[model samples]
Target: MRRPWGLALLSLLAGVAAIAVALGPLLASSGGVHGFAFSTIGVGAILIGLNALRRNRRAPSAGVLATAVAGIGAGAIGSVAMLGMLVTSPGGPTLLPFAPAGPVVAGSTGQWAASTTQVTLTSVAVVGVGPTKQVVVGNGGSVRLAAGYSFRSATSNPQLDVRLERRVAGGGWTATGIEATVAPNAPLTAATPAYSTTLATEAVQYRFASGTSASAPVSVVYENQHLYTGMAATIYADAAPYCPNTAVEIAHLGGREAGDYAPGALLIRISTAVGVRANLTRASQRALALHECSHERQWLNYGGSQEGYAQMKAAAAADFTVGDNGAPPIEHAADCGAMALEPNGYLGYGGFCTRAELNEGARLLNGQEY
Candidate 1:
């Protein structure tokens, strides 16, 4: 009897549909490695079975049908593997979804550490940056960070004045300090300032005085910090750095918003500059992030809005010592909230809003009514 090849082809299509339905949740919960590997194997096996059926198009026999059946059975191998994984583990579906969460104490950097100022800054800033990365996990996690940087004088006749700097998640890069003893034709013993950061790695950057290098640093000797499991807000670098001196997203340009308020999700905003070098310090970039985090809390916790933020700031200033016209209420309240996250609540009290570089970046960093 001639084999009903059309019926077999339909079976292959049906099997694919069934696999998608059955494997979807498993693939999602399979935690990346096992899920991806086994899924590929399973789907690949089914495809192979279907292809074999197609090759013997002329006259099909019982032997050919048996081979097709065997191939199709191979696809079931994934379901078997997934079942094994579920049976082997005590907790059926627990996996490392993100960095772990746990208890944490904010850092006490004492007074603000000084850095080279590109522009006279203002009282605009970001607060509670360290905690953004130091998450509290239940099963434990690691935040890969770098402490110090090492460099070499790429120039043969090197007139090198090297400085080391670091920035954390979506914050500005700050100059740590100049290196010592970069002698003639020796190893890259010059030290750059040591700084730590997290994978919001978009904002995390290391600045070495290789102003004219064809390549930028893509990798770092990152150190990791173990953490417990839970969810928290984190800042990530924008796809493209902002146009020079433009803070956050250019709200005026089109439909994109710098930050937005929604349920459960926190929107932390940051400023980006492209070719136009922003005159900013690491501290200022951080301060800017803190200010944005405050906005996040405001949006998530409270309904963050222009009118609402303004009203709240006025209320807060009346209760607290919110300085003169130097820092606008919206910016000032953000700074205050940012400060509250510090070990010493007032560590960055006036750090961000009280600087000169606070001009365009400041007014626009968090979007002030000023």
Candidate 2:
């Protein structure tokens, strides 16, 4: 009996592909060991069945039949595992069939820590434009809430319910309706929409909930009421070590720019129209301000506007000519710097930063003067 070389080769190739799929991005993102096990078992069983078929092409042996049956059973289990991976991976397909009713009680126990920034009056400024006319131009700032969770679970699927709650006037906690279902074993970082406290002060709290178990409430107070004020305040605070005299103000940029930094004036100007837009969230607004502040640090490091602007222009022109990575070196540096200052909040850079740039950004953020 000539060995079925073609069948053997096909089985090997299919087995390798199956294993690759098992250990690929889906498994990496899910951070689940069960996925790997199921995938391995499924691949092994399928290979075993294929081998049995190749060896017993003419004679249907009882042992081959039993082996094939076992292989099928393992393959079914593997299919279920693959389905779970798809459901859990970020941006993966939704598990419409297995969707839960209400919040799925987390299968694992976890604890969460809250990160909050308070809105302050310093972010808002009242200026007298004329003898009798006064203009309020700075942001009134809002409370920003972000949570990081750590979980311990023995089960294959572990999820946690994260919620951001606000304290009402009567002191009762009300759900802000901002929530997310996250895997416990993975990097669990969740944030609520910035609470608008520009009209009045607000108390915001956050927690992690799982099957009637909840982490202790963590809270922060926001006490400012001007548009984009909190974002400006956050930028100023983060930039204080680098640019002590940094100032932020709301200005009309005529839709030409979201924000800009004036080197000599030490001013960060945020667009009024952009800030007031309904869809713009506070986190994104803060990210914009921080990006401008990075330019401010760059200017100070470069000595003055003459040197800084010249270098920036040259970099921009070169980037345009070469079509380098969609952003100029200066802009890329600023994006990295902003991310360094607010790792969880800033989402502008789209993860295009190099290691050297990221390190420089950290140094620039930490008062590394020219």
* TM-scores vs. true structure, each candidate: 0.22, 0.33
lDDT of 2 by residue, 257-294 (tens): 67776443346777776546724566666567668877
Among these predictions, the greatest lDDT belongs to 2
Model 1's C-alpha root-mean-square deviation from the true structure amounts to 21.9
Estimate, for each residue in 219-239, the C-alpha lDDT of model 1 and write its tens digit: 222221222111111122211
Candidate 2's C-alpha lDDT? 0.48
Which 10 consecutive positions of candidate 1 have the poorest summed lDDT?
A: 116-125
